[model samples]
Target chain A: MKLSLSSSPHQRVKRDTGQVMRMVIYAMIPGMIAQSLFFGWGMLIQSVIAVISALVFEGLILYLRNRPIERTLTDYSAVLTGLLIAISIPPTLPWWMTVTGVFFAIAVAKQVYGGLGFNIFNPAMIAYVVLLISFPAAMSLWLPPTTHAGITPSFFDSFSLIFTGFTTSGYDVTQLKTIADGVTMATPLDTLKTGLTQGVTYSESLTKPIFDGGFFEAAGAGWGIVSIAYLLGGLYLWKTRIISWHIPGGMLISVFVCASLLHLVNADYYASPLFHLFNGAVMVGAFFIATDPVSASTTPKGRIIFGAAIGFWIVIIRTFGGYPDAVAFAVIIMNMAVPLIDYYTRPRVYGKNADKGRGKY
Target chain B: MTDFRDLSLQGLWKNNPALVQLLGLCPLLAVTATFINGLGLGLATMLVLIGSNVTVSLVRNLVRNEIRIPVFVMIIAAFVTIIQLIMNAFTYELYLALGIFIPLIVTNCAIIGRAEAFASKNGPLASAYDGLMMGLGFTAVLVILGGMREILGAGTLLAGADRLFGPIAENWTVVLFSTENPFLLAVLPPGAFLGMGLLIAIKNIIDAKIAAQQTVTTEKAARVRVTAES
Candidate 1:
């Protein structure tokens, strides 16, 4: 028997799960580094814990189900989940919170939904939201930038703080923030929320130490650098064709347009487009979390709609809702609408007669 | 005798009122934020279930089939009212915490469902036992779910135990870990749903594993018998 070579159309692109997941992991590195730099090493340690736990859980579940564990483990989807969870959490969260989030992300979100492509909700976002609502205090504990603190946690301290809840200095991670002039340090967004509630004008609140050198109002110092890095990584993915431009592009545009409109109406109340763009997980969410293959819309048009809806909802919830951050909630809400969006936005095949028009058929 | 066991098993697992039957879910999901809370409600439910079941069974032979549904509902409502008043008097804090859910217990389909389906048809002893087992099963799940949520949400167990069990349980909360930041999501409604889902998934998985093991053993035994015959 002779083995024949096929032509271009017959020869497929040769993509595998491992390759796709690897690209995603690669795309996440710049953002991970930025998180480590700004938030301190807690995120990095959490990432490590999450990644290891996810892989172990994934493997265990696969073993229980009698699936090919090694092959599935190599795909790096578990790694992506870890990265997402790490970035979403407070850098100073305790070890068990990390473990619990990973456990839920893998066991409940992924495995119980039949694993990988079958999960209806974004596993990482669901875990993050669950942790956030369940542990509000831990979830909201953000330290000021290292520049303000005069103390940056060493990599080892970061590790210790996350696991043991105390740095080598005997100070708990929550106590390490700068307290100058009787003012406690807070994240720029948190500061803004509290300030606004206290009737502080947006521009006046911008003078707070947390926003000292930050590029835009309400953007945490050093956070914009991370956002920019994530944007760069997202652009690289788009350039390399690793991800389509529809979802990210649509999400950015919608957020920009919406924030602009809100700012135009009342600049005093609403944050600027730049503030919305460069702050709290907006860029990371636009490019990474919202683009999950399973939970996102399948069709090109649907992807755009899904992305825009998430952006729209984020703005609405952030501006008016109780939570300081709305990315996770927005993503989960949009996840539920993906199927409906895909159904309505499906492209018609060439030369195929149009289906019955509304009630006419 | 096996019939009794099967009935108990059916109420507890196979036809669980809260899970499979999806009856009494409102209260089950709402108040199950701690083990003691779940236990409190579950015990209250058991009282109502038993009282209603016995009353319905006694009147089952006297009432016409056409009006049996209304009669059963009234009996369940009456028992629920009695249970609510007693709880309000004894466990005021818990009663306040449970609030609408206690009265809403009147609408708990599990109580009415037993009255209509089992209690109205079965003998008094069986009916009462069924109600007791079903209520206990429901309470057991509630406590487990509540414990899971409380532990995850507040890093404590039996938080505010005094609310349900009174002063002995005051400060009975065992802190699993003390963090300035408690997980707020676990105590929230969404967490309740997630915890409940995990519980259901766990039950299903155990059932699946047992079924698979049974199938394997039966297959092996059948093959051995066939080879011996040959």
Candidate 2:
């Protein structure tokens, strides 16, 4: 009788790392498009700069380390890192700063930690944190959406602004900070934070021109569109089995549950759960950063715990911590705990008896 | 010679006060926002180190072993007081800028560590030299790390130079490129940690390269021996 022998119980999966990474890139497209439409061409320019820089830096480091450069480049992890960083940064960030961020993300955050699977923190989030802390002025320089300002920067202008630090017409970024009034618009989250601290009520704070057009109802206009697009992408990821539901579900539930409790206790002091959900980077973080396969927990229960912890930390830090937006810090903090979570929450082996303790037999 | 090299290497890399030994981190992280800040503290620590090491060595045989820690600490505190007064007299601006760190040097582990490990066993001359080398090494790292943070964070170098070197380098601060705002992360405590981590990483890479070269050479020699025997 003829018999064939193969590797034990082997089952090949059709999807590779490249495909998975590419799907994420594809999913980010709608959000990127929304951002461009509302915000301007700066995000697009930054995205391109980030992707190219990430690739080049990744390639250089891999070559220096004697790793297979082509194989590492093909996985698209670096591209994903770049995209996340690009989206997080102010669209008008100078070209060199963007390059510096990408290089740091790839070289220090990813490669220095033994690269890829070995990295303890999310590379993109690290870059965001680095940029946010380092260049607060540039990082906080968010232009009013084109709808509000009636000025949509041309692609060439954005490109020039990024590369040369000036608009095509020779206006520096500082001059372009605000549009109609002396309002001096800050990000919605930042406004809320500063406003609350200055003894302004939540509702009163939302009355600022920055939140005009009934947009803060859905997290202001431009950011709301971007958030919804990210949510759609996240749902697609969940449905397609690209990611499991544990992290997103857990994170969203924790945020809602925590925000609801706080709101109930003091309605005037706290924003609604919906406000917490739709505003800032919570949706993006819930779907994207928390779901990072490498830094996040592996086991089903562990993933839930990890996600919930991040959500909880986000709310706590946002409310009590120094920073207005705490998603990046929260995610990085929880990233450190994944291993312990996975260790304790490991599922039982399929055939092992449930009652059998370590000392039993 | 042996004591000096070992102490210098220990302070510089192997047993770095800030990195490996994790000593005096309060001042290391706090005052390292700029090169002048770090240099000022580093020089202060160096003076204290030399004074304490020499004093500790001189009294090594006189003090009872049981009461030695307190004695060593007292000596360190005394030296720190002297350094503080000198700085307050000459570089009052730097003394003010460094603030609590100058007084806090009395509690720095690197000072007491040398007193315990090297100075307690060696003669005064050797102990003093060891303290000098170790202090210089620590100061060098501080200056380098401070420079990196200042340049990246503020896009300037030798910021606050007047505080350390006097009015000559005052406004000697060249704006490498003016940003609308400085990089806050680099100025914050986290930036200090990250900058220190990168410095350590660079040191590790150099060590790894040297180790790799040694292994290659050893393997080549082994191969040559086998071939000759065959």
Model 1 lDDT per residue over A216-271, tens place: 54576887788998998888878877789999988889989999999999888888
Question: Tens digits of per-residue lDDT for model 1 on B1-230?
Answer: 42889888998898888777878888888998887888889999989999999999898899999999888888888888898999989899989888889888888889988898888888889988998889988988898999998887788898888987779878887988986666677788877887888788788888999999999999989886785547
Worst 10 residues of 2 chain B by lDDT: B1-10
Error of 2 at A128 (Å): 0.6
The best candidate in terms of TM-score = 2
- The digit string of per-residue lDDT tens for model 2 on A186-219 reads 7778778888999997788777776776355638
User: What does each candidate score in C-alpha RMSD?
Assistant: 3.7, 3.4
Instruction: List where candidate 1 sits over 4 angstroms from the true fold.
Output: A1-12, A180-182, A216-220, A354-361, B1-6, B61-67, B123-125, B151-185, B205-230
Global lDDT of each candidate: 0.85, 0.85
Error of 2 at A43 (Å): 1.5
Kindly give the stretch of ten consecutive residues in candidate 2 chain A with the minimal lDDT sum. A174-183
